[model samples]
Target: MAKQTAKTTKRSLAVINTIQKLGGATLDELTGELEIARSTIHLHLQTLLEEGYLTKEGAVYHIGLRFLNHGEYARSRKKAYTLAKQTVTELSDRIDEEVEFVVENDNRGILVHESFHPDSHFPSKERHISTAPSSAGIYYYLHSVATGKAILAELPDERVEAVLDDRGLPRQTAHTITDQDDFIRELEQIRDRGVAFADEEYVDGLREVGRRVTGPDGSVLGAIAIIGPKYRFTDERYTTELPEILIEYVDDLETEISDSYLDDYR
Candidate 1:
């Protein structure tokens, strides 16, 4: 009985630490890392289960879904996403450009919403962005486009540094920024200004104009972007007057979303 109790206590500590630090740990990773007997680990997990601290799947353990339900509820109530749609779509039509909306999730910008060319095909610098589920979030590397850079510009340096350290920069195109120092400088420029651009940097014949969009709390909600071929984009709107134009549209989006929340309260 004494041996069982000590084993239980140690396993409990391991489970708690794993959940707290890594967010989730699969059984294989835990067992291999901890070098604990499966039966011993299972007993402590059963105790944590009874106490409502952790949950286990077939071979993995993670934070409970209860936390996720609450988080989703809060996200639904946020005015940021609710308010940005019309403006995003309108900006797409106004510029006849491919536009997208992103939010920071898991320390990377996720493109949650988008409005694109009639067929919805948008030319990305080195890679083409397809509206199909397979291509949307999973394709482009964060450093591969202006849209991604605009979102990255808003992150804390330490956090961005960690991401680069984790992924390193994979070369997609010759124009893609592969140098760490050069990329950091670009991020700095984006922070100082309110926008970032990919000037045929990630792909040949493609250009993008990107601007940061913010919520009332001033957190970067995401970015709204215009992307197209370098020839037409550089000649007409992008180099000419589109910066101010997109900025105005963003202002309209903020006001519109704020009104949405106000209407909901009323």
Candidate 2:
């Protein structure tokens, strides 16, 4: 088969993303969003509709559920997803709080798995988000959220600098670290202790503890975190009890993944 041309691929992907963002849209809405002519949008829509990748109702177009199959297939290939599911559930039950398993992708963290008590309310449950500067102008300060800080701690200095250069250290809260030197010091502390803490730097009333998961060869897989209200996750518990438990869970997960899915590192 021939490879798709860049122009074709770009336009097609943009069209798909536009529909996804709008939830459902008419041809005119898509045309306006994409800045493409009506005829061009209609052509792509016709092709997607014919291929069952999109569906239409009353002149509005929406993404087809067929993408679920593709998403499931992609997720099934990640060993961490399955390994994280059980551990995240147990952590949630153990802490009676919200727990999340996140993986770094292109320097951003994606919430791949999550477990939370029914009564708990976690505002940061977005499926995807930047690990550092959170959406609401709230900086998860790579050193703030346990998961982001843990991963940052394990990375080499040059790589960490690159991430900072690309995404500046913006202050999200009064507690956020705006100075790179101060952030480096914080990362050094986390490395020595093998854990990270959010400390209400990301969200005023929220706190989180995170530990990084590694492969047998010490490749970073991701990080798992226990999150909740600051009132419950006190400074004492965060510095003491919580790190011990989160580290244990991360240890078990790392060992299992290293033994069973070593190929992931390659």
Candidate 3:
């Protein structure tokens, strides 16, 4: 009984995550994918349904909207995220490109907020750029994206090593830096330049420039990035112009966050 009780929580969470990944699943489908007993799966699904974490229609079980409440609550707890959203929106409008503010969590980067200009061209279907509000939950590998690498550059070498240990450098494109030594050198360059660039590293035809935002206490808050097509981000633009523009916005965002932090105590 103790063993069963101990395993119940982990198994139940796995069931929820699997259903979310599959969009929706039937009891038999979940049992097949999870390789758990049909009776046990049914028990877990029924409990989740009763707890308002899952909803069933006909024979299919889907993740419930209750998770949105938790997600919103988690986002609200980050004061910097609230300030960064405005910065992302403003930068997107100013540059007429897609802008995003992302934070590192558990060695992965999560999109806290994103904004797209009206003239922004959508990437091919193979890429995962989403203009919807739901895109806030999207996660990316730290070594593959400009914003993620910018955040990684701000972190200590030990913490960065830990992140690499937790999430290995997977090749997303031919340009991705998969070697540990090369990646470490790249971070060093980013630190020296105060900005990071991803030229077709995460996606085949996309390029991005990112700068890290830090709080008044010098802790890494997150990173903000501007993304566009490779053609638009030419040599001078990618290396100098866009980075200068991005750094300006990140500087303003850091100052705003610092001011807000001071205001809270006063």
Clashing pairs in 3: none
Relative to the true structure, candidate 1 has a C-alpha RMSD (angstroms) of 8.3
TM-score on alpha carbons, each prediction:
0.63, 0.81, 0.93
Summing lDDT over every window of 10 consecutive residues in candidate 1, give the lowest-scoring window: 130-139
Every model: Cα RMSD to truth: 8.3, 5.4, 2.9
User: For residues 1-266, what per-residue lDDT tens digits would candidate 2 score against the true structure?
Assistant: 99867886678778888997787899989888997778978888899889888999999999987776786675457776788778999888987888877766656566667776875565553423333322222123354567888888899999999888977777766887779998999999988989888777776777889988887778787789888887788767877898899989888887787777656446
Quote the positional error of residue 57 for candidate 1 in Å: 25
Number of residue pairs clashing in candidate 2, backbone atoms closer than 3 angstroms, sequence gap of 3 or more or interchain? 0
What lDDT would each prediction earn against the true structure? Answer: 0.70, 0.77, 0.89
lDDT by residue for model 1 over 1-266, one digit each (tens)?
Answer: 54445756766887767765565777666666676787767676677777666777766677665554654565456667655656678888877776777666655556656676663354452145443443334334667677678878887889888878877787866788999999999999878767788887757777777787776667777777777776667665775477778788888887776676578789
- Top of the candidates by TM-score: 3
Tell me the spans in candidate 3 whose CA falls farther than 4 Å from its real position. Answer: 1-6, 125-133
lDDT of 1 at 37: 86
Q: What's the residue-level lDDT of 142 in candidate 3?
A: 90
Of candidates 2 and 1, the better by TM-score = 2
The TM-score between candidate 3 and the true structure equals 0.93
- Per-residue CA lDDT of candidate 3, range 1-266, in tens? 44545678889999999998888999988988997888999999999999899999999999998998999888779788898999999999898988988999878999888887877665551247554534788889999999999999999989999999999999988999999999999999999999999989998888989999899999998899999888888889889998999988888888888888889999
**Model 1 CA lDDT for position 93:** 85
The lDDT of model 3 is 0.89
